[model samples]
Target: MSTGKEELEVEEDFPVVDQDEVVEPPAEVAKTNLAKRRTIDALLAEKRLQKELEDYPYDL
Candidate 1:
């Protein structure tokens, strides 16, 4: 039963947020997060390599 004009009017009632206005974490927090991410990435890479090696054992 709602019309298109009514939907458009409803959408205008909310305020829009600008990306620049968003707040960022403090430098120390950002650094900690980055370190944690790197550790996780390294662990994932190690696991993948181990799996690949197991799949194809080498004779030396």
Candidate 2:
């Protein structure tokens, strides 16, 4: 009974510690993400231009 209590106490004293790890993206994955980002940017720019054209005043 005393040994069991001691084991529990030891476990309580030392909690689990998490180790953070920095993972780097692979080259092919990085390239794919960059391509997707560029496509999204182009689409957004086109939408912005269309909005501006609609809002432009043609009363010159």
Candidate 3:
């Protein structure tokens, strides 16, 4: 008697990462990324404030 099951094969196109091999960015690059993020956040906050001001009723 044979088991009615077929083994499936899968091929991965990306490299496998090991938890031990994780690394952090260089200090300079990290600082640059942080600055960029802060700028983006400030712009978003300004946009939200502008929208709220537009929605506020000045006649009340």
- Clash totals for all models, in order? 0, 0, 0
Q: Per-residue lDDT of 1-60 in model 1, one digit per residue for the tens?
A: 767566453545778889999998866678898999999999999999999989895776
Instruction: Please give the distance, in angstroms, between residue 11's alpha carbon in candidate 1 and its true position after superposition.
Output: 39
lDDT of 3: 0.90
Deviation from native of the Cα of residue 35 in model 1, angstroms: 0.1
Model 1 misses residue 30 by how many Å?
A: 0.2
Give candidates' CA RMSD values in order: 10.1, 8.9, 10.0
Winner on lDDT between 2 and 3 is 3
Tens-digit lDDT string for candidate 2 (1-60): 355545443445776555655555766678898999999999999999999999999999
Lowest lDDT 10-residue stretch of candidate 3? 1-10
lDDT preference between candidates 1 and 3, better one? 3
Instruction: Please provide the root mean square deviation of candidate 2 (C-alpha atoms, Å).
Output: 8.9
TM-score of 2: 0.53
Error of 1 at 36 (Å): 0.0
Q: For residues 1-60, what per-residue lDDT tens digits would candidate 3 score against the true structure? A: 657697768977998899889997766678898999999999999999999999999997
Worst 10 residues of 1 by lDDT: 3-12
